[model samples]
Target: MKSSRSITTILLVTLFLAFFLGSASAQEPVELQWLLIKFWPEYDDPSLLVIIDGELATPGSELRIPLPADAELNAVATAESSGRLLVNDWREETTADGKRILVFSPQFPVFRVEYYTPLAINGDQRIVDFELPAGYLSTNEANIEALLPPSSKDIELDPPADEQGPTQDEVHLFQRTVGEVKDQAIRQKITYVNASGALTVPETASSSGALLQPTPPPAEETQDKTATGITGNPWILLLGVAALLLIVGGAVGLWLTRETDENEALPAASPAPKIKRKKRSASTTIRASQSNLDRYCRNCGREFGPDDRYCRYCGAKRQTVP
Candidate 1:
């Protein structure tokens, strides 16, 4: 009875395991659309930028996307639906011919990842040729679209001109349909002239276009002077005006000084008014003589007492002067 019970349990577990495995394998792969924009610098090789937009019918714990062999893995980022960047749990491996493979296992249902790959310049024209990898486990309907930089002119695609999509940003669009995910050898090749001949490097390899450094106007043409004296530093003009103002002010001050000297003569100093003194009469000039002075001692020229016969100061005999 125990042996029979054990056999029944084994059959039940096997059936459950089989059912789970079948359901997981049957899940449909996500639909993927890859938009790649190749930005060409005036000089140096062009850079390839990629944007991936897709929908997953079966949300899985991890996701994987194939990148170009020469991709810069450090520049990889996963973005949310609202365009906010989410933490990426990803790693990369170098492949043959300096190409790289980026693997990301994002936890989101819908996400976007962007990165760049350096392109090679072959012959005179810049070229981008690559094979798309099939990383999806299950079958998926996928499409690939490529945009050349706006400055790119004389662009040519691998799939004849008729097979190309509409022109956008002055460059023809190249698209390929990879219906149902399989190890199909999907390929893309593009050729174009680097519009500026790579004379100047691009500041940004943006999808819209590369932001180029403006070419300076020709030296000979730019040398022409304008009617207004507004060339060069404006501070120089200000300094000239200030100097003119100072010169005019000095002239005005000198003129004012000259006019003041000429119009108003300094008063000639009059000999301080002669002080008038009245002539004195004889009676006013004469003063009454003292009687003691009249009776002065002759030997010492000292005044004597009223009845003393000798001067007390010199002890000489007193003599009268008439």
Candidate 2:
């Protein structure tokens, strides 16, 4: 009985440890948010711009993402949010078709990685089509969005329900949630027009001119219409003339009143005071110099009365010159 009880105790402890370990693993499982792919085509060059943005859960700084083997990496950047690149340590390694890995160790647990390549050529039918990376778990339930460039006027997007058919910028959107699927495919075809078939500036200008051309009536017909309108509504013509006259009269009255008020408000300019000078005799000039009017403080540099003892400005003693 003792041995049996010991065995039972060991079994119970083992089961408990297994349960705890399983729960811990569950908690550490990765969570993927979204994968966005974008394509921009260049008319001058046959190449297209391919950009990818992916967000996933990472308990630690390390994260691994699989991409297509043929994908070209131009610039690789990571961020905590969209459009903002964060500092991270990253490297790329070629894997089998099942996995082409882009490994990153970001600063944060939740990381977004965006990278772009400008030299992806279209396959047959002038269409650039491919499947996304594999090894993504369906349980993560990640969302996906694919954008196609403007060069392709005639474009087709799969899973039409999720298709936001060509936007004004000519980019198409394939936005949807990744379900229990292992791989996602994106296909795009570009339709081109020859130079001769393309619209010319002169052609467009001619069409615009057609719209601007006006159909004017003959001078005689226009004169007859004007005469008939005036005769038919004599009262209206008179009313208009009367309104014009009233407006003119009111304007004239306003001008006259304003002028009269202005004239009345201003004081008649008095003849600028006649600064008449009387001829001064020599004796008057001699008497003026005898008075204190010519006295000035030497120390303070101010004029003062002749009886002052100290300069008012500087408090200096004043001396009378003999």
Candidate 3:
């Protein structure tokens, strides 16, 4: 009986160990490629932009990131390869330890989170105490960049930056890089004195407008359709005018051809009347000769006898003197 009890206890322990190992293997943390944190005071209030670029072992999985309890979320988005930002849906949750976290299921691997937090300001000095919590993620690399105000002087950073220089935009920058960030939170403290209290960007340009929001991707199809609509109307109008002109020309041509055919199909006009000449009869000619008495002989210049039918001197026929 003692041997059987020992065997049973060993079997139970083995089973418990197998279950624990399986659970541990299933809850593996998501791996991040890089994390970029930027602190800028260009807006009406100081802001933080956190860009998380990572690949998910399982696509469409839930992701959670921890933030300060007092932080107010301004925007959350997923970035495309084309650098266009698409808005993402998220919700806020409170942890058991009284900390706040952002909860969302990301369909894509890369996402961005931005928020506004309180900046400690006293007189002409400003203070920023920023923290990045490692709730359930790990990263191979991390970068932090902070922009100082335009007229800031005597700038200071705790855990001093690795480099200090002016950025391409001519703004003073404090930069730091970390390797193999895992299972630990990152903290930074920056202080500066700005007697003028000027911001990195103008206040009017960043005040509760489009500057505060992420720019949406352009709608190429809609714009193409609008351009087609604008340009297509003139062509349609021109075609209509051309068709009308052709119709008018065809009608006129048909009318002119019909008129020519009608004139050709009619009979020719009648010719004018011609005058005829009358011929004299032989009896009329003999009466006119008998009435005339004065006569001359033919072939001789002599007087003719009465009722002579021939010329006596030359024996030639006498011509009538009619």
Error of 1 at 41 (Å): 8.7
Query: What TM-score would every model get versus the actual structure?
Result: 0.42, 0.39, 0.53
Off by over 4 Å in 3: 1-28, 42-59, 204-322
Per-residue lDDT of 118-218 in model 2, one digit per residue for the tens?
A: 44333422344545534432234444555544434444544432645666655445566545434443333333322222222222322113322212223
Pull out the clashing pairs in model 3.
none
Error of 3 at 167 (Å): 3.1
Which of the predicted structures, 1 or 3, would earn the higher lDDT when compared with the native?
3
Rank ordering of all candidates by TM-score, starting from the highest:
3, 1, 2
Query: lDDT order of candidates, best first?
Result: 3, 1, 2
Tell me the lDDT of candidate 2.
0.47
Model 1 per-residue lDDT tens digits across residues 47-143: 6555555544555545545666455432334456675545455554333233344445655555455555676666567786766654343345556
* Candidate 1 global Cα RMSD: 35.6
Q: Model 1: residues >4 Å from true position, as ranges?
A: 1-45, 66-69, 79-87, 93-100, 135-139, 160-172, 198-201, 205-322
- Global CA lDDT of candidate 1, please? 0.51
